[model samples]
Target: MLQETRLIMGMPITICIAEGGAGARSMAEAFGYFDAVDRRFSTYKADSEISAMNAGRLCRDAISAEMREVLALAEKTRVDSDGYFDIRRPDGSLDPSGIVKGWAVRNAADLLREAGHRDFFVDAGGDIQADGVNEDGEEWRTGIRNPFAEDEIIGAVRLSNRGIATSGNYARGRHIYNPRQPGDELDDIVSMTIIGADVLEADRFATAACAMGADGIYFIEETAGLEGLMVNAAGISTQTSGFGAFEIQ
Candidate 1:
């Protein structure tokens, strides 16, 4: 097995291949893709495409195809989630921070699959995309961390060619926006984990659910091919009926 972590796009991106070191080159190329993604998408960087657009230096029509696609996807999420998944920052600038990690991770995962890598995982922060089995010949296990307690796991998910994403204050503080109040802090929910058909959709919905407060679980329940768990500030939990199907238990 070959596994490594690299800091990219302002997060620890861990890539694991269930093969020998011969997969190292592909993994390196995967990281290179991540690097390029960061250079283009990082909102904090003054030269990034997002920053350029926010600074009014880059025209929206002149943006790269990937940037356009990401923004388009963000807009779709905003619509699908009824504006809860919007990327408009407090400063009134576009910030696709919500879904870029999953998007980029999905891209890397696709690289592995295209290269005939059957068993691999690309994890960007808590958003994960994995396929096939691990070294143990079992599904990849993703622990959903406790929001109120560091290093404590509240649950574990068994992913088989699926994607999982957890959104909480622990990873990025209250970075998630409550679009209804615009600039108001998220108070109703402390954390939310979403398991979906793919990481891109999962992460976007997770962000939207975080903004939806405890009611987000209902949103996931109603959505097709998605299941979710939401924990409120008081530690009360709720989840879709099928969510337990992904549990590692």
Candidate 2:
């Protein structure tokens, strides 16, 4: 038997598992870990880890091993994407929204693993980490929303033991607010989705790559371990190496 539970991690989060008996309770316990971490580390919150770092109250030396890992990832992503995925705005405030959600989701998934749950899915907002097979003993199916057409799905992918993340201008609007442009207006790409082993890295890469516009698509293609599918403003779709694994529905 399969059971699903919804846990509040500041935002609503769903955990699905196939543990037969007590699956729901185990899923809830797994989500409890997420809630605790969300309260302590969520960058979206005003007093969270990144906020403390931005305020200079949380020294880099004081950062936990987990926080340090995510921060290091953010720094590496900034460099790899040529500053497209900056955690701080010009005002020096932290805006790690692009990466934090996926990071949290991945961590929550890890919690499930630690709890002895073998098959599960953790979704934080649009970011996801799916392990094992679904109800039909098949890979989980996830849809990629069409940025140009609201409520329409451009494609879907079936995955097992992998992560999938999408980035677009539709949610927050604008192309991730170009740091280089400052106050200048920015254009939005149709959508960009990436699949990889780590949802955290894939999420940040997708956002940064989309923010880079057409030029970043080439960079994404050259980057190793990451596969991307991008829809341009004109609705043309392009794929990076290994992106063909995604089935366009």
Candidate 3:
């Protein structure tokens, strides 16, 4: 097994390959992709493409291919979530941080797969894209951290060829807000975890659901191919009907 962790995109990204065939070069390639993504999409950097676009230095017609793809996905998520998932800030500036991490993680995973490495895990911050088995030869067990207790894990979910993401203000502190009510803080729901077919799907919905507050779990319940667990401010936990199927005993 080969594992590496690096700080990229203002977060720690870990990539673990549970096989021997893929060497250090494969891992370097994956991490390099993440570095390129950060340079292109990071809003915190003055020279990033996103920053240039926001500053009016770059026009939409002149944006790169990756920028176009991220924008399209952001628009799709906004429409799918009824404008709950949006990248546009109250000031009309764009910040695609909510979706970029997961998108980058998924792309990194694809890069590894293209190199013929199947059993691997890619985690960008809290969003994860896991395929095949872990080093123990069992399904990847991803834990959901307790919102009230940062050091404690509430539970673990078994994932194989799937993605899981958690969205909450506990760690980041009031980073997500309802697009409809920009000023209203999403204080009702402290945490929301979504599992989907891919990291991008899981991440986009998790952000949207967190913005929905207590009603987010219901949205996950109604959405097909997605299972979610929601923890409210009172520390009460709620989950979808199929969530149990993915939970690790």
| Segments of candidate 3 deviating more than 4 angstroms | 171-187
Q: What CA RMSD would you report for each candidate?
A: 4.8, 5.0, 4.7
Instruction: Give the higher-lDDT candidate: 2 or 3.
Output: 3
- The prediction achieving the highest lDDT against the true structure is 3
User: What ranking of all candidate models by lDDT puts the best one first?
Assistant: 3, 1, 2
63-95 per-residue lDDT for model 3 (tens digits): 999999999999999998989999999999999
**Tens-digit lDDT string for candidate 2 (127-225):** 788888887787788788786666898778887788878787554345443556543333445577888787786788888887877665677788888
Q: Candidate 2, which segments miss by more than 4 Å at Cα?
A: 1-12, 43-46, 171-187
CA lDDT of each candidate? 0.86, 0.73, 0.89
Residue pairs clashing, model 2: none
Per-candidate TM-scores read 0.90, 0.81, 0.92
Q: Compute the lDDT of residue 158 as modeled in candidate 3.
A: 95
Q: Which has the higher lDDT value, candidate number 1 or candidate number 3?
A: 3
